[model samples]
Target: MQRVRLVDVARDAGVHPATASRALNPAVVGEVSQATVQRVRRSADKLGYVPNTLARGLRTSRSYVAALVIPDITNALFPPIVRGAEQVLTEAGFTLVLTDTNSATEVERSQIASLRAHGVDGFIVATASWHDPLLDELATEGFPTVLVNRRCATSALPFVGGDDQQGVRLCVEHLVGQGHRDIVHLAGPSNTSTGRERADAFRAAMRDHRLSVRQTVIECSAYTEQAGAAGAARLMARRRPFTAVVAANDLVALGAMDALGSAGVTCPRDYSITGFNDLAFMDKLTPALTTVRVPFTEMGAHAARRLLEWIADQPPTATQSMLPVELVVRGTTGAPPVD
Candidate 1:
């Protein structure tokens, strides 16, 4: 058997071998005419031609691969993001490698180092903290990295996320419109941008509605169910009187609901709760959740596109990309119960 080569495809497509090469290389395919690109691709397919990526990498000094670093693979919030990113990368003739650090900085550092040694072209990272030294370092070293679903406080790296302030404002307005006067907030970790921005936005919204902001924030240690449960427990222990709770994310909301139910408190009857992220199956909960809908899939796709632009030597026009959000009304929220 003989191996198919670029010359064979070029001969069959009636184009030069150089044109065939550009047509096959996604990074430079746009240099050729669309018709020629299609013709070359068809010829390659008919001849069972496969580009030698290893040889191309050696000549171009690029692996044509991007690494997506996330905090947790099992979190329902992340699968949509992964799917969106993979689709864009595959279309661009780039391989998408997914890795998780389990929310550990040390593990993240090690994984990133390993990927760098393997010649990954760029990174789409979703595990940034508000004050991440590693992210700062990456930016200082001129790495082509984009942050997804999270952002650093002062790092120069580009980032894409939902408009946290707008999302919180929508949640607050919805709860207030339903007559939730005394609302408590289950905030995420102060160390992450999502947590800080959402918590701050909640305060601003509450103040706008003439509600006292005192004792409204219960800071959760992480964005997990366990952290949500612990934060709810602490709020209960404080004996605060509130008719509604605004959770930072959907998982936190679920944990809070479980904790409240254990103490014989039911949603909308005794308390109203609103959550962020509007994750999958949120509408199918025992009492369907009212949450802020973030377009996570779009967010992921946008981040990957941004990274590709950087890899192509095109600097982004802006440092941040904030996606819009919507308030999803469900069964979990209602007018405050009679005192």
Candidate 2:
């Protein structure tokens, strides 16, 4: 079978080869007239002509590929984010590559270096820590990078994430409105921005409601069910008198519930609880989870677009994009159990 060439496509589209070339390449397609670009694309499609990305990369010094770095691939919370970013990148004539680093800094560094060596154009990172040295290094090297769902404290890189502080405050406010005063917070690791911001927000919200700011924050080692279970168990060991638990995320919330149940405690009967990030099937749980809904898909889409803009030399003046969140009321939350 004869491979369809650019000249044939140009001829079929009734345009010069140069015009067809510009039309087919997304990076330079904007230079061509819209009508001509459409015509050329239609002709290429009809002729089954595939763009030679390798040859084009050699000429333009760009692979037209981007990398998305995530902390864990197994987490249900990341699928929507990946879907959103993939759609945007695919429409823009770019390939999206996904890599998970198991939330390890050394693994993240190694994976990033490998991706860069492979000639990926830029990165959309969701694995940044609060004060990541790798992020600072990437900034110093002038890499085209955008952060999602997390941000580095010292790096100047642009970030796209949900309003974590607002989410936590909303959770606290909702629980307080339900007549729960002595609430404890199950927090993620302070090394990450999401953890720090949400923990701080919980404290501030409690203070705003005139609740005591005592030793109410129990820090989890990670944002996993195991960590959450251990944290909850540790909290229970202290025999703290609390009526509600504000978990860092849905997984943590579920773990806390499991731990409580093991000790013959049940949600909303013995204690009310709320979680952040209304992950899939939260409503399907035995006792439906009440949580804060962050726009994960929107965050991913905006982060991809922002990374593209930076790659196009249109750096955003704003350092951060904080999407809004909503509080979802469900069966897990209620007025504090009658004493």
Model 2 misplaced regions, further than 4 Å: none
**How many backbone clashes does every candidate have?**
0, 0
**lDDT (tens digit, per residue) of candidate 1 on 144-252:** 9999999988889999999999999998898899988989899999999999999999999999999999999999998888888898899889998989999999999
Clashing pairs in 1: none
Q: Candidate 2, after superposition: displacement of residue 118 in Å?
A: 1.5
- Give the Cα-based TM-score of candidate 2 against the true structure: 0.97
Cα lDDT tens digits for candidate 2, 157-239: 99999999999999899988999999999999999999999999999999999999799999999998998899899999999
Please, what is the whole-model Cα lDDT of each candidate in the order they appear?
0.92, 0.92
Cα RMSD for predicted model 2: 1.3
Please give the distance, in angstroms, between residue 46's alpha carbon in candidate 2 and its true position after superposition.
Answer: 1.3
